[model samples]
Each structure stands twice: as C-alpha cells, then as structure tokens.
Target: MATSLFKEILFRKKITDDLNVGERKIIIFDEANNGNMGDQAIVYAQTEFIKKNFPTDRILHFSIAESIGILKH
Candidate 1:
C-alpha cells in the first residue's frame, strides 16, 4: 500500500513536470468510482465545467480507495 501511494505521488510529480501544469491546476483530491450515479455525475460535471471554463488548465484526479486508477490503468 505504501509503495502504491509512493508511486502515485511520484507519478503525479512526473506528470506535472512532463505536462507543465501551469498556474491553474484543477485537482480532485478524492474521487470515487463506486457505481453511484450522483457521484459519477458530479465528477463528470466538474470536469466538463473545468474544461469549458479553464480550457488551458490541467486536471489531476486522485482516488482514495482500494483500487487506484492512475496506477492500475
């Protein structure tokens, strides 16, 4: 678990360095994909809003659950 967390952290930094996340970084700290329609819609809407409003900004989504998507997928 600790290793996974560490890798996730490193990957985040690497992505920032690689993609050059500028002043506007939209970070969704804790995301859930537990098949909840409301939750999914919230995330979707949040992302869409960001994309429409902050077109040039970057989005970093972190999942605080048993299955972390960034590393797994």
Candidate 2:
C-alpha cells in the first residue's frame, strides 16, 4: 500500500510538472467553514500552500460539505 501510494504521488508529480503553469487550473475540495476549527485551519493552510507554490496558476476551492465556492489567485 505504501509503495503504491508513493508511485501515485510520483505519477501525479510528473503530470503536474509536465503541465504549463499558465494554463493550469487547480481545484481544491475541502470541508471549509463547516464549523470545524481543524478543518478550517487545514483548508486555510492548504490554500496558502498552494498559493505560495503555484503563484501563477489559477486555483479554485470549494467546500465539499457546504458547496461554497472560492476562486483564489
């Protein structure tokens, strides 16, 4: 299971690396603002991490539990 998971990660990394940043669209689905402090913090951290790593890519986030959509730069 661990080996498969590692391979999946590497495959995803390769796919992401091959994509053009200018045309890439990243969608983040999380349980955001659902009255769970931990979930909220996780979502916030994920958003910041993505923004920091992919500064030029378009990022869209949606609350999987609440259907709240957020478009972030």
Candidate 3:
C-alpha cells in the first residue's frame, strides 16, 4: 500500500546580535506509491530527491497512513 511521507525541517532564526535565536519548523508532505514491492527503495529515492532540492538545517520524517495528493504553493 502507498503511504504519504512527511518531512519537517527546522531552521534557526537569529533574534539577537549576541547569537540568540529561535527555531522554526517547515513541514512538507509528499504522497508516493509504496506497494508490497520496492517500497523501501522508492522511499529512499524520494528522500534523496527532497534533500537535493531543498537542503535544510535539519530534517524529520514521518509516514501518513493514507495517501494524499501533492500541491505547490
């Protein structure tokens, strides 16, 4: 079965001249085919694509139980 993959990236925003900062989390979700065959490989490939396209400070991943359509804004 296919699952929706979620990647959240956190970035530090400088708030003060003395190095104080705040962290912001940006969430991105992508739906992919993850049937009984080649699910892991597909997921890995998708991850690499995201990493190359949207390099960030940190990344967090999760799987959604349901499939979803992707949209860009």
Candidate 4:
C-alpha cells in the first residue's frame, strides 16, 4: 500500500524537487528493521509510504533489520 501510494505521488509529481545535487545522491532509509530509538516512526511510515515514489536504481531501500550502526559513549 505504501509503495503504491509513493508511486502515485511520483506519477502526479506532487512532491517538490528541492534536493540539491549532493542531496539527490543520498538514499532515504525506511529504518523499519533498525532498533535505534531516535528513528522517527512516522518517517519510517512515510518512507515506506513513499518508497516507490523514487527510482529503484537511484534509491537504496533499507529495513531496520539491515541497519547495524553502533553508538559509542
């Protein structure tokens, strides 16, 4: 459902192309598989909701399970 919605947004071109050249290179991470506390749940939903809006080749889809970042004290 999320993927479909994103596709719709992209198809309609409703989203603003405000990204810069450097920003475009960044991949939006859904973080569903991640265990970090700082990760925004809404953003995850939004990410999942709008994933298909972007090109598959250019975007890197990552789930919470795939994230393995370690925080140091």
Residue 27 of model 4: what lDDT?
Answer: 48
Q: Residue 69 deviation, candidate 1, in Å?
A: 14
User: Which of the numbered candidates is closest to the native, going by highest lDDT?
Assistant: 1
Give the distance in Å from residue 39's predicted Cα in candidate 3 to where it truly belongs: 0.2
Which rank order by TM-score, best down to worst?
1, 2, 3, 4
Task: Candidate 3: give the clashing pairs.
Answer: none
Which number leads on TM-score? Answer: 1
**On residues 1-72, what C-alpha lDDT tens digit does candidate 3 reach at each position?**
121221111122221233223543234344344564576676777678777776763333434422132222
Could you tell me how far off, in angstroms, the CA of residue 1 lies in candidate 3 after the best superposition? 27
The alpha-carbon lDDT assigned to residue 5 of candidate 1 equals: 62
lDDT per residue, candidate 2, 32-72, as tens digits?
66788988889888889989999987765545642322222
* 1-73: candidate 4 lDDT, tens digit per residue: 5655444444454443543335453345434544554566755665665555744424444444323221110
Kindly give the stretch of ten consecutive residues in candidate 1 with the minimal lDDT sum.
Answer: 64-73
lDDT of each: 0.69, 0.60, 0.40, 0.45
Pick out the ten consecutive residues of candidate 2 with the lowest summed lDDT. 64-73
TM-scores for all candidates?
Answer: 0.60, 0.53, 0.36, 0.25
Show model 4 residue runs off by greater than 4 Å.
1-24, 33-57, 69-73
Task: Please list the residue runs of candidate 1 whose C-alpha ends up more than 4 Å from where it truly belongs after superposition.
Answer: 1-16, 19-23, 66-73
Let me know the TM-score candidate 3 reaches against the reference structure: 0.36
